[model samples]
Target: MEEVSLGTGNWDRLTGPVREMFVAHARTWLDEQSDPSWALLDLDRLSACTMPVLLSRGSTSPSWFSMVLERLAAALPRAQRKLFEGLGPIPHVTHPQQYTAVLTEFTRPAEAGEPAPGR
Candidate 1:
């Protein structure tokens, strides 16, 4: 799964719907967060693309995808925050603790994860 986010500049408004998903990963990512401005830069770095499918049995669930989903869930408002919980841990790539670790990192982890403000 690919992820995207827009910032304080109406990226969400600019988004359009493609097939299967919205055209604006940036908008979707940002709106999911409490502070859209912080995630603004992610918009530039992220884009729609064909990602390689990892074939490891451990890759079945896909750690990379889980990472994106977790962050998306945490970015959303509390009422809508259940998105993160729904992704479920990646079969072999992520541990239960990783769910929190990944989500918190997406918002603002001390180290090892993308912090808010897109740094």
Candidate 2:
């Protein structure tokens, strides 16, 4: 298996020890996985959320994941979608700064008594 995240970004900036640590963690996480109950997902439960939601996906992610994201975004009452072009499955790991900036912008509090943006 690859020792690093796919696509370009600051993943190259990781030190040898840090990279090894991530690899170890990835191994542990992978070793602990069981078959997911994808069919049991409750799409209707998504409608219960009152907070603003931001749904994102990398352009290169698998079709099934993207389809799920599209459905979840559509089900939510207040949700915004963002597509990260030229990234891989884990955009946050590959593009931390950009991800953090977008997350901060989306989650920032609204001005006094004013409606939040992107709702």
Candidate 3:
């Protein structure tokens, strides 16, 4: 948990329920470590998806996460990517208002029959 806090840099900012959720799912997180399926990426299938996709990551997140998001954006036909500057892995927990605003902006275009941001 300490490692997670250090890695995310906002674990302590999470609400009690949110923190509890992570704690409750600790076993699932551990199990995912050895899950081979987790490593699989069916880009073809992803590309076939027609729905709008929002790919987000915090600026402070590890570079690998940005790489993964870039790959997804390339694979998805209508993918929009957003970087939350000054935040870490769990941006929603650390900065809910900003996260919510981002989400709202992303959906607003869709609601008005327009393309998502960055599309």
Top model number, TM-score: 3
Instruction: Please list the residue runs of candidate 3 whose C-alpha ends up more than 4 Å from where it truly belongs after superposition.
Output: 2-8, 110-119
RMSD (Cα, Å) of model 1 = 16.6
Q: lDDT (0-100) at residue 92 of candidate 3?
A: 73
TM-scores for candidates 1 onward, in order: 0.19, 0.65, 0.78
Clash list (residue pairs), candidate 3: none
What would the per-residue lDDT of candidate 2 be over residues 3-84, giving only the tens digit for each residue? 2334444457555786787777986656544447553457789888777788887776656667778778877888888888
Model 1 lDDT vs. the true structure?
A: 0.36
Q: Model 1, which residues run further than 4 Å from truth?
A: 1-58, 62-94, 109-119
* Sort by lDDT, top down from the best: 3, 2, 1
Superposed on all Cα atoms, model 3 deviates from the true structure by an RMSD in Å of 3.4
Name the regions of candidate 2 deviating beyond 4 angstroms. 1-36, 110-119
Residue by residue across 1-119, what tens digits does model 1's lDDT show?
Answer: 32222112222333244322545364664566556454343522233322211211122333544465455444433212223332322322224454455445445634655344334
**Model 2 Cα shift for residue 12 (angstroms):** 6.3
Between prediction 1 and prediction 3, which has the larger lDDT?
Answer: 3
